[model samples]
Target: MTIASCGSVSALTLGLPNSSAVPAEKATLPKGLFVARIPVSAKTKQRLANDIETITMLSLLRPSNTRLAVGTRIPEVLAIGLRLHAKNAAIPTDIVELIAMQRKSGIVFVCVRDADFEGTKRQECAFAVRRALPGRAGHTPTFKVFVSDWKPAGEAMLDIGDPAVDSIDALWESLCSQVMLGSASPTALDARMTRRMQAAQLAEQIDKLTRDHQRAKNPEQRNEIFTKLHKAKNQLEELRKLEA
Candidate 1:
């Protein structure tokens, strides 16, 4: 992927064949991934652009067996990017769509935790990414770092844990190490992800039943929905317990 000027469309370029033609298990190379969103504060926007640039440079220098070119950028590429970065403001549909995009491109996402997570957000976000694997929603790997920790340190002389982030060269070295580690171990997550996926499915079913209950015009229909809703609620409770 080549870096464009800030606010310009970012494009991902991989050296591998079009991923669609190859079986996924055989495609071991990595693709650059960025998530941007609308209505971000100026600080967030600048941070996003900087991060994208860093990813672009890293992608360009990526090793031969490790760099995979997916394709040229499409218009909705930015929208999918937005969805991944929007977090709480992003709905399930947006997340589902973003997951689809990542899966299709065989790219790994990079995300930040909340603003208050401080230097620990990178590890926290990494765990979150690992936890997301069982949903079968996407097939992309993710590497996370704590970029939300920017508060003018003034003259405090900070004791930064990963000083590599202080410059692009150092940061790329860290990222390359991460990619070499490969995707989160699906085997380790299998049992947990299975339970989590079931819980998610039950939650979605409960939501649908509640909506149906609200939309039912007749008392008979409403009663039917209520019965299904009650059953779904119980099932969801069980699923949650299993996940826990």
Candidate 2:
């Protein structure tokens, strides 16, 4: 846990507003639980994405979110969220690297709100977000954040415990005492997210090919995609086993 003074990482993730080179001073004691909630009176409502970010910043301030529940739709918040939640915990190096890699890879989940959320299903997605409880994933113990938001994409529910994501909360708690913003405009998306979107699109292509092979009337095409899918499934299984 102390290999690389994680206190610096802590400072960066929690919006200290200092440069990376600047060292952080010891934090003062906590005051009280300050949740931001917006009451609708003169204003109709704020933009979803902006509101999500504002609330996210508030949740990360204290760094102890065990009792806090954050909700957002922004994907950029994942890196910040992960870092914030990871500060006090002892995460293994492999998981830490994987997190850093995921942050670098920028792969994101897009919630599919269709009535038939195929990606959100247990078997389809390979993991059950709601059932994972809190603060970990698998025997590997992926670092967890307290504000767990379930994003239903297809049949797979991308368990977005990260506060950085905008698609996390369906409804922002009005009295939450924070600004609101969810799933910002594409302009607001970071480079990491853009890359993630590209990767997702590629995954979709592969998925279609596999499904087409399954549904193909022609035996040749069906065999082609089926073979590919079999290889893919096996590869994913191997990766999971490694993570496990």
- Model 2 misses residue 25 by how many Å? 20
Question: What TM-score goes with each of the models?
Answer: 0.32, 0.25
Q: Which ten residues in a row have the lowest lDDT in candidate 2?
A: 123-132
* Residue 114 miss distance in model 2 (angstroms): 24
lDDT of 1 by residue, 19-130 (tens): 1122223322222232443333465445444322222111122222223222332111111112123322211222223334443222222222223344443211220111
Backbone atom clashes (below 3 Å) for every candidate: 3, 42
lDDT of 1 at 201: 88
Alpha-carbon error at 66 in model 2, in Å? 16
Best by lDDT: 1
lDDT of 1 at 161: 22
User: Which ranges in model 1 have alpha carbons more than 4 Å from their true place?
Assistant: 1-51, 55-188
lDDT of 2 at 83: 23
